[model samples]
Target: MAKQFPEISPALQEFILRQRVFFTASAATTGRVNVSPRGTDMLRVLGPNAVVYLDLTGSGNETAAHLRATGRLTVMFCAFEGAPMILRLYGAGRVLRRGGPDYARLLATEYGGTEPLGARQMVLLDIDLVQTSCGFGVPLFDHAGERPTLARWAEAKEKQEGLEAYRRQKNTRSIDGLPTGLFEEDPVPVG
Candidate 1:
């Protein structure tokens, strides 16, 4: 059976915290929808109805562009190891750049205790709906270690060229030419 909630319940929060992977989906008002898998230690629950994730540098900035264009987002997490369940958070989100006030506050609150990673942006979601479905068909899999490539790349680029160049060259416009923040000065890069 499926269930719905107005916000992330306590049980849902526990499940979310235990999950090692999740997926994010977004789209502009017209262009193709993007669904991307996310993992690592980059996700955080901010409140019962809010969450944030560090957006690492990637080949495309579809999520950021889509949010800028439509502000709609969906984050889904499937239980592949424990119970058979899938949780989906439907919400609107905003992007925070490295130097912005929100960015500085979030970074200080969430990760300032540790050395900074070369995270380019942060996607802060204000969840409006929480839905769960029986994921009976989801396959169980053994947990593997995290991939070190992205962190390595980001670390290597830290204080170097930065991700701005990459964002400018590859993330300036969505596939549909939606006006993303890429062209603006100190534009926020998407994950």
Candidate 2:
């Protein structure tokens, strides 16, 4: 059986907290849809109706572009090790770049003293609905180590000229030619 809720329930929150990876999906009014697998300790649950995830610099900025164009976002998590449940959060999101007021406020209020890890953007999702389904077929997998390559790259860049150069080189636009904030005259870091 499937269940739906107006907001995240306590049990759902507990399940979300245990997930090591989640998938984000978004699309514009037309054209291609984008689905991304995200990890690396960058997600947080702000409340029953709000969630935030750090968006790192990548080759394509599809999520940001899609959100900017349509504001629709979906985050999905499946239990791969423990319980047999699948959860999805349906909502709209806004991109908060680093140095922006929203970014500063989220950092201060939600993240506290954590340093930005060269993230190019933060997607603040205002969840409107929560849905759960029985993940009876989701296979269980053993835990493996987190990949350090991304953090290492970010750290090295931070030690060098900083994230701005990297963002300029890699985060300029989505593959579909959608505009991303990377090429802005005054780009803000978002991680």
Candidate 3:
């Protein structure tokens, strides 16, 4: 059976805290939808209705662009080790870049430290609905611990020159040519 809750409860938050990975899905008015697997200690639950996750620099910035275009976002989490549950959060999302107004605030409030080296922005979701279902079909697997490859890669990038040069080259647009707002309000060059 499935259940819908008005807001995330403490128990639900605990479950989220236990999760090592989650998926973020979003799309714009036109173009392919983006579903990204996110991990590491970047996600944080802020109060009952809002959740914020630090977005690291990646090959593409589809999520930021999608949110900028549509504001629709869905987050999904499945219990793979302990319980048999799948949780979905439906919400409106916003992208706050590294130097944006709320960016530092969230880093101080939710993260309690300086912005990480590879952190490009913060994706904040104002959750509207929470749904949970029995994940009977989800396979169970033991937790193997977090992978350090991404951090190592990002550190290497930072050491090279920083994200600006890389963002200019790779993250400026989605595969479908949708603008990702990577340069804030800079002009989108024709590639």
Among the numbered candidates, top lDDT falls to 3
lDDT of 2 by residue, 60-167 (tens): 789988887888999999999977999999999889877777888877777785656866778989999999999999999887879888888888888998877777
Question: lDDT (0-100) at residue 82 of candidate 2?
Answer: 74
lDDT of each: 0.83, 0.84, 0.87
Candidate No. with top TM-score? 3
lDDT tens per residue, model 1, 62-104: 8888998789999999998988999999999888865678878
lDDT order of candidates, top first: 3, 2, 1
Clashes of 3: 0
lDDT of 3 by residue, 6-78 (tens): 8999999999998888999999999999999998389999888989999988999999878877889999999
> For every candidate structure, what is the RMSD over all alpha carbons to the true structure, in angstroms?
3.3, 3.5, 3.1
State residue 118's C-alpha deviation in candidate 2, in Å.
1.6
Cand. 2 Cα-lDDT:
0.84
Better of 1 and 3 by TM-score: 3
lDDT of 2 at 3: 95
Q: Once model 1 is optimally superposed onto the true structure by TM-score, how far is the C-alpha of residue 104 displaced, in angstroms? A: 0.7
**How many clashes (backbone N, Cα, C below 3 Å) per candidate?**
0, 1, 0
